[model samples]
Target: MTKDQLLEMVRDSTQVMTLRQKLALVAMLSMPAMIAQLSSVVMQIIDASMLGHLGTHEAAAVGLVSTTCWLFGGVISGLATGFYVQVAHKIGANDAKRARSIVRQGISCGLAFSACITLVGLLIAPHLPVWLGAEEAIRGNATLYFSIVALAMPLLMMNSLAAGSLRCSGNVKTPSALGVMMCVLDVLFNFLFIFVLDMGVLGAALGTWAAYFITMVLMMYFLVAHDRNLRFSLDKVQKFKPHWDTLSNVLKIGTPISLERGVMSGAQVAISGIIAPMGSVAIAANTFGVNVESLCYMPGYGVAEAATTLVGQSMGAKRQELMRSFAWISVMLGMAIMALMGVVMWVFAPEMMAIVTSDADVIRLGTEVLRIEAWAEPGFAAAIVTYSVFVGAGRTMGSSVLNLASIWGVRLTLALLLAPTMGLHGVWIAMAIELTFRGIAFLLRLKFRLKIRE
Candidate 1:
């Protein structure tokens, strides 16, 4: 079947469903992705809990450096997004050859980008904690953790490229399943390495690295062996050279995303700087709270993925009305789901926090911050899904600008101003406020833009 025929098949299969049915379909489609995200977070929680047993210093070491690693990783992921989204659009437009070409470019870009990041990350890993203002007790472990993650950067980038290509072809299920498996494997490996083998922080890092390598292999096998729209062809490889046109197109879509993520990473560092002087307890609590809260936020991310696929395809087919309809529907659904999650989180904060730590102080502090942030979950959902909508429409630069302004202009400024005075509570309050603003701004953008029909 042609690519357009395939998209029509998907749409027809989905369109007949009732609103509830469509939501259900979306939810079902997202379940594997959700599980993938949940498992990943669960592994982190497990890793943190295990390290917490080694004393707060080890846990803090991992916590302090994790965000920096994530920052570097996000840039690579963003680069893949460009080519992947274009693949979705091309497939929708009934151009499989073009889609494959984009995929090849994504592979090339992902490897080159990963190598550059790995080199920089390795060079700076030793001094990262000192630069972040980490306490002397936690600095060495933090540096080691950063170095291990940096070494695995190329594998992680390749995994992102494969997963993104799969998702773009409307194959979310495979990637999601593999992601969940990756998380489970990480936890299992961490158990053996950290406890059974007594490798400490190194064990945790190695486990995560192994998980990525395995997942990358699995995803590659599926794309090459099973996917009809994407298969590795020796003939294509012989013909492949860097296409400036495709590279420029991908970067046009991706650069802003990278900047947005990069800026957010910077803001995280800035926020960390503000919280650094407040003492270890506050920093640790903040770290725990962020990870715990990811559970609530991740579902929104799943919905956003669906939105990106649906809206991008709609745009490609020149179904502008459908694109707008999908965008609004996705935003509402995401917010509703997140709002419910927030309520549950607020009600059960202590119980949830207790699972990750035995210390009364950490649990108490974490519970408070989680509950506080829970109030802003709906707004957070709006920002998350609307950004997806913009990306689907090929309007990423504006989204990136909004994200940077929101984080630096609103979130960080408020965080810095409040963290010293209010402690962790102050930092979360700033986050809640910024999320609300981001949602409002995105909603307005959606309203004001001229609806373009392809």
Candidate 2:
């Protein structure tokens, strides 16, 4: 095939693609993202292992402040979605000029929002460890880690916008490559700062921040200088002012997503609080369980990224049938891929846990939770990708409502009711059931709600 033929194969819309062609496109879009997601997970596992070696308290210290990372990251994801989704639609509709305009406006809005996040995060860092109910022994280290990481919010948000915009333009490989590079950089910096320099938890935080800083620079360079469809131009630099209309649409789609993520992350902090009182071993295992379970679900997230781009662009092009078709295909692909990862988790839970921690209790408890969570992966896939579909169509409210409801109403309530008797196992079972419920709920909406609208 010629270079142009390959581009056509990779970039053609679902309106012209057969089912097999669509699946091939899905793999092309998703596989790089999947590897990127896995690379991110591997970096976190490496961090956990190094922290675990430092002592249970060190691991617990990082864990105490970890959910805050999710909370912040969730908001950044929502913010980037607003602008990038618009770009995806424009690309689909062949309005490359408008798409580029939206990209410019998006960077402005993202940076503005990052400023707000930075101010709030810094002000609260000292009190965050206390608020999370972390034990006194690890509170200082936790505070330091939180502060340093919080300072990097702007770099992280910038990277999110740059990378997301590039992906939405159908150039996934560049961002994926940079993501893997960042992960590797994170470990190298972590090794030097954490062990050779003996900075402990603070070193870990600095290392991650440095990686974000460097990656953000390169990502922006690629978006501005090299992207095939949406490269930025200094002459085309729109005034650094709010595009009120664009901002309004972004808010309409992003607010619920932001709210959904905020609630989910907040609920996690609460659950961590519950785990905190159970002692360091419980805390260590809970933290370790979370990082381990994430590996199995990363593929689902990878495909979800593809769903958002494909569906958003299709909707932009006014091809409702194509949009719906891409949505279903993405959902099924995510489900199939994650289901296999789930099986792997069930079989190798102990080995995975061992790589993160040597504590027998930590390994055993983490393994049990992974097994409980394994059965829920298919359902988890549905929720992840379907929600991406909703975001692509700028129909985020319903899915966000469902996610907030399930995570809070089902997961939190059950964890509370069962934790006293069943402990960490109870928490995992609650998570598993809630995921299944969420998946079923998303599919119902996709079939009945989206179908009727169509």
Top lDDT model: 2
Question: Model 1: runs farther than 4 Å from truth?
Answer: 1-6, 9-25, 233-238
> What is the C-alpha lDDT profile of model 1 across 1-454, one tens digit per residue?
3333444644442443235544554565556666777777787778777876777678778888878887998788888888888887886676767778778777777888899999999999988888889889888989999999998988987788788778767788889989889888988999999999999999999988998899999998887667777776622553346698888877788999987898799888878877777767777788778878888888888888877887777677666666777788888988998999999899989987777777788889989999889999999999998998888777899889999999999999898888878898999999999999999999888877625543
Candidate lDDT scores, in order, read: 0.81, 0.87
Give the Cα RMSD of candidate 2. 2.0
lDDT of 2 by residue, 1-454 (tens): 3322433533455426677767777788899999999999999999999999888999999998898878988887788888888888788777777878888888888888988998888899889988878889999999898888778878988898888889888888899999999999999999999999999998999999999999999999999888878876634555656688888988988888887898899999899887888889999998998898889888888999888888877777777777788899999999999999999999999999999999999999899889999999999999999999898888988899899999999999999999999998898899999999999999999987653143
**Which portions of model 2 miss their true places by more than 4 Å?**
1-15, 234-237, 451-454
TM-score of 2: 0.96
Q: What is the lDDT of residue 198 in candidate 1?
A: 97
Error of 1 at 306 (Å): 0.8
Q: Candidate 2's C-alpha lDDT? A: 0.87
